[model samples]
Structures are given as structure tokens and as C-alpha cells.
Target: MRITRALGAALLTLGLAAAPAAADTPSPGPSDGKAPASAGTSFRTAAEIEQGQRATAGGSAGDYLYWSFPADTGQRPTVRATVKLPGTHAAETWRIDVYDGLRRRQSCQYGAQTRTAAAGASSVELACVLRTVRAWAEPWANDPLPGTYYIRLTAVGLPVLDRGLPVSAEVRVDAEDIGGPAAVDGSLAEPLVPGIATEDLADDDSRAVLFGLEPDDGWSSGWWSDRWVWTAAGGVLAALAGVAGYALTRGPGRPSRVPPGA
Candidate 1:
């Protein structure tokens, strides 16, 4: 009996120790590969790039340069951008904005998301660090999920002369995977990437023509969620409690039998 109990305790201890180690293991970062050669003018045309890749483009100061990158669950992505101003120009303010696959603007945790340059300043730098992406989220919650994220860079505040002036911009992104600690119990059915071909929707969808859009496959296929699991568990527990209450509180077996018969 003593040996059996000792063996059982040792196995339990090993199991407990292994779980946390697996959960805490960190995932690999994005590849340090070649960057995109150019950026897109609009969201639909945004040049796709991988994390850790840099992108450069030349355009007018007022142009909206867009870039896109993929992000997985447990990652906290940071976007950095730098704009080189023309030879001579007035003070200008540049800004960088990040949006999820749904085009909803994501709030930055911390970074110089916007910066101003003096008249003689050579360049302005901006960055945005987004919250950790989740495997799944509630329907109402706008938590970041695994998908494609877009970055838009432009001069939000600039003089009229600076609007049409030539400017060069560089953009890059870095995603850090925090591993199992940041992971959720459930995940999305599929990533929020563009599923429909642009040509197929050209004639049927008016929005596609207007915006040059490529829509995402929305949450039609039910996504896996922790709420469903919790609900089922709660229901089972309630049923068990009902059965237990009946067993404990019911009157004793109809008084067993008549006293005379005994």
C-alpha cells in the first residue's frame, strides 16, 4: 500500500510540472526575409508582406500608402514607419494607423504613432504596437484575432505646399508570439483573409466596383468558442444537482411498510 501511494504521488507531481512547461514555451518569430518592393495606394491593392520585412515607396505627401501582413494567435504586432520629407517644406505631421482584417481600427498600446517634422527636418518616424491577437473572441468584443492586418501611412497634417511634394516612405512590422500563456481555449474557424476573388464579385457587388474591394469570408461557418463549452458544462452540472437533491431530500420509501405487517 505504501509503495502504491508513493508511485501515484510521483506520477501526479510529474504531470503537474509538465503542463506549465508546455504552456510557457514560446513560438518562433516571423522570418527575416526580403521586404516588399513597393506599397499600395489603397487597401484593396495593399502590398502583402511578411513580418520582419521592410517596404519602401515613393509618393506625394498626401498619398495614403497601405501595406498588409499576416498575424497569428498569441502575437503582438508592432508597425514602424519612416517618411523622408522633400528638400524644403513647412512643418508636417505624419501618422500611422493599424486596422484589423475587418477594417476596424485597432487601438495602439504604445508607440510614436504620430510625429511632426520641422521645416528643415529630414524625416519623421511613427509606430503602432497592437494588443495580442486572440484565437477567438466573443461576437460583440472587438478583440484582435488571427488574420491579415493593414497599415496605412500618410501625412495627416501638412501645409498645402507639402501635399503634392515628393516624399519617400519605409514601413515594417514585427510580430512577437507570446506562446501558450496568451492562447485561448477556442479559435476562429478560419483566418480573416480575403476569400472571394475580385473578378467574381465585380458585377454582382457594387461596393467592389466603388472601392476595389475583396471581401473576407465572414463568420458564417460557426466558429469555436469557449462559451459553448461552458454552457454545456453548466447544463450538465445543473442536471446532476437536480438528481442529487431528489435523492437526498425525498421522503423515506413511503414509510417502508405497515407496522402490523412487520
Candidate 2:
């Protein structure tokens, strides 16, 4: 009876542990049909600094590394965002909201006007012209300790208009700026390239090694490169080099051979 009771208790404990995990596991799909994965817009890492050191402020010399901010506390700092709408949606209205790490509603702006598609096309270019529009709540003012927050953009009335289309840049906030809005003087590093796309973005290791950044695990660097394919290529090159080195060091000789049927 005691053994059965103990077994029951063990099973109960295991079930309890599994319950939280099942709840915690994130669902890969959207919550509802309201929003699907966005395919048009993209995310970029504007400015990121993994560690601090004294460098002449501004002018691209000591810019932050590439990464998104509000990683685990407070709100993310906002920077310039320029979006090119697809030449499909005729004239669309959109709203963008920035939230803290905890998914709480933060600062939001409505009616960032987007120009209509120029007659022949159905999309337009929209840029944030405001001199530092407030996108996130003051990092400190957040009820939940602010952390890496998400920038969500939605097109009102047009659920399919621009939802899930990822668009935004990561503006890293320094230790001092934690729980506070970024300073006007705070700035983002220059882009890796002029146009937006994976081709124009930086590689994860390359960006970190170059800019000196260390972001939280699982954070997308917003840079894309085919890692596995490149790795295989590198291995092939190394093998070829080894073969060449052996041939060169072996010295020319009429290759030694054993006597037939010795």
C-alpha cells in the first residue's frame, strides 16, 4: 500500500512539472487568423554595443554593435526606420506600437501616413520623419522590470495588410539608460549596407566579432548567411590544401612498385 502511495505521489510530481513546461512552450503559429507571418518588412540591427569603453562619441567610430534591445528589462530605444511598402497594397494605413520585454503595452503612434501607390504601383515608401517619436514607454516607468521589448506594427482594419511582416531595428541602450528613455544624443551605428535584405545584412559571428557584441541567446542578429553550406565549403578547401601539401613535399619520383608475384 505504501509503495503504491509513493508511486502515486511520484507520478503526481512528474505531472506537475510537465504542466508548466507544456504551458511555457511557445506556439510557433499566430494566436488567431487575425495576424499571419509578415513577409514584406524586415528587422535590422541598427546600433549595438556589447561592452563599454571610452571612444570618441558619435560619427560612426564607436557605434554600438548590431542587436535588438530591451532584452530582459525595460523598453527598447527607438531609432530611424524607413520602410518600402510592397507595390501590391494600394493605399494602406498603419499603426506601430513598441512594447517592453514583458509584452505590456507601451508607447504607440497612429496615423504615420503612407503615401499612396503612384498610380502604376500599389505600394509606397514611408519613413518616420518625426524628430524622435516616442515608441516605447520610459524604461523605468514600466511596471514589470523592462527588458527586450518587441516592436509590433499593425494596419488597422486590414488584418492582412501588414501584420506579421517583421519591420524594425535594434537600438541598444546602455547601463545608464536602463529603465529610461534614450538620450537625444544617443545614436545608432551606420547600416552595414545601403539596401535592406539578408544579403545586405551582417553575419552573426562576423557582426559580433567586428562590433564587439554579446546578445542574449536565441536573439536573431537580423543578419542572414548560409552557415552549413559555407562550413562544408571551408572543409573541402582544407582537404584540397592538405592533398596539395602532401604532393608538394613527397618529391618527384617514378613511384616505387613491388615486383610482380614476388
Candidate 3:
């Protein structure tokens, strides 16, 4: 009876010790799916790079949601926006456009660039792919240059006279840095093309993200992303400690004496 009880207790203790792996996992940071800034807040001249998710500010129909970011040579940027319709109105429509620092609309290849849908049945999704921004390009052509770019979201089909409908929007931009600027001594990556914004944007606004030096230059995906090893190590250490404590409590004593049976 003593042997059976001890074996059962050992198994139960191991089961109880399996919970630390989940506890050791770290929490997410600001860049990982952090909420977006107030909607309708982004502007043409004041647009900034926005990551994760954020809701659009409410206002009349036909309002535009703008976002801007600086692009480096060899970097491919993707901008996508999801707008939730307030109600099922066939008259409502939405569109997304990508523009450069000079306000020239960049061309999109895939089906994500321009889209239109009604509000009642489902939300509308739009994506603009500004393929690799070239470092050196013609001044006449509207090719994408390594500089500031804009994302404009507009409600396309709303009535011209009706007060704008309050539609919520979510914007996500992922700028994958493929390679370096290949420093050219004194030459600029591309001319610092100025934007056409009029509003006086604050210095501390969270809209724009300026990519700095790489943390793990050799890392392909991201630095310190390998979390499984640490999780497994922690769980193993915890289980071994629990087992050692149990063994110490049992000591090297003689086996339990069998009770004299009737």
C-alpha cells in the first residue's frame, strides 16, 4: 500500500510541475500588435510609419486616413487597411492609394492596391505594394525613390452632400528591410524629397518610424526570437528540482514493513 501511494504521488507531482513553461513565456512589446494611434489622425504631410493595429477617428463620410513612412533602398513596403462599416448601406465605398514624397501615386501590382465594397455584409480590405524603392532613378519618371511615402484611405462612393459616416479603420504597414544602403560616400540614398503637408507635426508623434541600425545584423528573421529553448530549459529545471526535493524527503530508509495480516 505504501509503495502504491508513493508511486501515485510521484506521478502527480510531475503533472503539477508541467505548468511553468506557460508562465515563463514573455509578454508582447510595443511593436508586436500594439494598438494604432487615433484614426483620421494621419495626414498627407504629417503621415508617419504605423505598425500593428489602430482604430480610425470617427467623422463624416469621405474622410481620408493617411499614413507615411521613409523607405530605404532595397526595402519592400506593404500597406494594408481594414475598414469596418457602420451599417449595411450600398451607397458607401472605400479606396486606398499609395503615393511618394512628391505626392505621385505609386503603382500596385497585385489585387490589394484598389478595392471597393459595401458596408452591410462585410468590411473592405485594401493593400498597396510599393515594390523595391530604387536608390537612383529618373527625375521625370514616377518611379518609387528611397524617401518618404504616403498611404491615403478615402471613402469613395459616399454621397457628395451627406454628412460623412463614422467608419472605423485599421491600418498595418510592414517594411521588410532586405539589405543595406551600400554607402556611396557623399551621395544621398536619394534626394530628400519634401512632402506637401501643411500641418505642424509635433516632434514626439508616434506615427512615423525611422529605421535605425540593425540589432542582429546576421539574424535573418529577428534577434532573440528563439524562445522555445529557454522555455524547455526552465520546465526541465523545475521538474528536476521538484523530484530532488521529493527524494530528499523520502531519505535512504528501510522499506516500509508489511503489516501483519489477519
TM-score of each: 0.67, 0.28, 0.54
Please tell me which predicted candidate would have the highest lDDT against the true structure.
Answer: 1
Candidate 1 vs candidate 3, TM-score winner: 1
Q: Write the per-residue lDDT of candidate 3 for residues 1-262, one digit (tens) a residue.
A: 4445555665665555544533432221124433435543454334344333343444445776776655555456777888776664565567888887677888875646656674364678888777765555656867666666677788765765533556677777666543333212122443444624344457744343333212122212211222334455456656666776777787777587788892
Question: Residue 27 error for model 1, in Å?
Answer: 5.4
Candidate 1 has which clashing residue pairs, if any?
Answer: none
Worst lDDT run of 10 residues, candidate 3, spans 215-224
Candidate 2 vs candidate 3, lDDT winner: 3
Per-residue lDDT of 98-197 in model 1, one digit per residue for the tens? Answer: 9888888999999999889989799999989999888889888889887778899988867887779999998888877555456567777776776434
lDDT of candidate 3 vs native? 0.56
Please write out the lDDT profile of model 2 over residues 205-228, one tens digit for every residue.
322222222233332222222232
CA shift of 67, model 3, Å: 1.5
- Cα deviation of 261, candidate 1, in Å: 41
Could you tell me how far off, in angstroms, the CA of residue 168 lies in candidate 3 after the best superposition? 0.8
* Model 3 alpha-carbon miss at residue 230, Å: 35
Q: Provide the overall lDDT of each model, using Cα atoms, as 2-decimal numbers.
A: 0.73, 0.33, 0.56
